[model samples]
Target: MTATTTPNSHTATGERADLLTALAKQRHFLRFTTRDLTDEQAGLRTTASALCLGGLVKHVTSVERIWADFIVDGPSAMPDFTAWTEADLARRADEFRMLPGETLAGVLAEYAEVARRTDDLVTALPDLGATQPLPKAPWFEADAEWSARRVLMHVVAETAQHAGHADIIRESLDGAKSMG
Candidate 1:
């Protein structure tokens, strides 16, 4: 669904606004890391880690989209991590790289679209207290349920963390810093 901005130019208020604002700030920092960089530069790994600026953007976009779906559709929205096939693992790994013909602009555009959808969901959800069962994954506790509020918080945290990673990668690439 297309995202709608409120008359006040804010999609939410109170806690939801706070969450969206935090997410937006992190998204800005993450995108800023790729400013003026060519596709090759964005895809280049500057540090020992495999992460690159464009790849981080793509990965975070996927993460935010998945968690937003989880908020709406429960654990069914997620993949069965325990039963992932080789192809599934390979596909997941591919999320962290800009493969041939994947431009940085394309990645950023997709990320923006996903962010808009997530913001719309946050604004339209009737209850921030709505809960859903967490997907079964090695990293998640078995049978735990998370409220929509918690899910949004997790998204914010993940974006912030990846923005930091992107910042490091950017600095190492060409000595560009997202912030002082």
Candidate 2:
């Protein structure tokens, strides 16, 4: 189903629009902090942690893929996490390190791709109340009884949470500041 914008949606600009604002804000924060860093600086962990800008991109991409595919697009295999276990321990152990060959551009682009696809699903599905089984949130009253509306809200919520995470990582990259 297609999403129709309403005349009374000036405040939030519709549900999807409101959510997109959060996504864009988060994306913007991530982009600016790592804007001109070389591949080296992109993954550099200044503090005693592994929470670098590049890794944050990777982390956000993983998150969008999960919510968009599982929560918004029904069931599907998450491609990003296929080999994650191998790098999982390393990333988890440290809060600010970049993996080999990891680039800010590449990871951000992938995240953008996932965000677009998620937007498509949200706009196409008319019934927010039409629920699907989200593997991550397995206890959500079962898949058959799930509502599209709830899933949409959940996606935004999840994105917002990660956006906070990204914000912290962004500040750590440099003395950069963000407001939104």
Candidate 3:
């Protein structure tokens, strides 16, 4: 099919459109899991896992933003996980919980904004084949490089994985399932 114009006026065809569609579907599932949840419920730990609904959204948002930056700026865009201090670890832990004064609406809004920027980047990037070396981290192989396409796929995977987590958490919280 020829490149089709999206409602947002972005033209994406083939692989780009496929990536956007997959990411959007996963994002919808993730957000849907939080429907009608109050801040208290969104913050509640529904299972043994430390993840909460709002925190999952927050974590996914951070992951998407960081990976999108990596696609644009190479290894320099990521944090030095190998050199994280205790404070850094603590702050990272906080991303999995809803801290005081945080609301579910606020978390979802930030996630929506990040998703918009990522979708925009996918639509605007000239080449999906644009590659960047991976950052130094224990979880990543040294000298590995990822194309923009690969980064986007990773983002979709992460979002989908967390969406599943959110589904379970939501079910535990109130027996509401994203899908029956």
Highest TM-score: give the candidate number. 3
What is candidate 3's lDDT per residue for 36-77, written digit by digit as tens?
A: 988999999989999999999999999999999999998898
Q: How would you order the candidates by lDDT, starting with the best?
A: 3, 1, 2
Going through the candidates in the order shown, the clash numbers are 0, 16, 0
Q: Per-residue lDDT for 136 in model 2?
A: 38
Model 1 TM-score on a 0 to 1 scale: 0.94
Better of 1 and 2 by lDDT: 1
Candidate 2: worst-modelled 10 consecutive residues by lDDT: 1-10
Query: Which residue pairs collide, candidate 1?
Result: none
Score each candidate by Cα lDDT: 0.90, 0.60, 0.92
User: What is the C-alpha lDDT profile of model 2 across 1-180, one tens digit per residue?
Assistant: 123332233223466666556555556666666666788777776656556667766776676676666654565543333345757766554434466666667776777787667666665566556656544333443444446666556655655665566556656777665564
Q: Runs in model 2 with CA error above 4 Å?
A: 1-13, 72-97, 136-146
Residue 139 displacement (Å), model 2 = 9.1
Backbone clashes in model 3, listed as residue pairs: none
Better of 1 and 2 by TM-score: 1
List runs of model 3 lying over 4 Å from the truth.
1-7
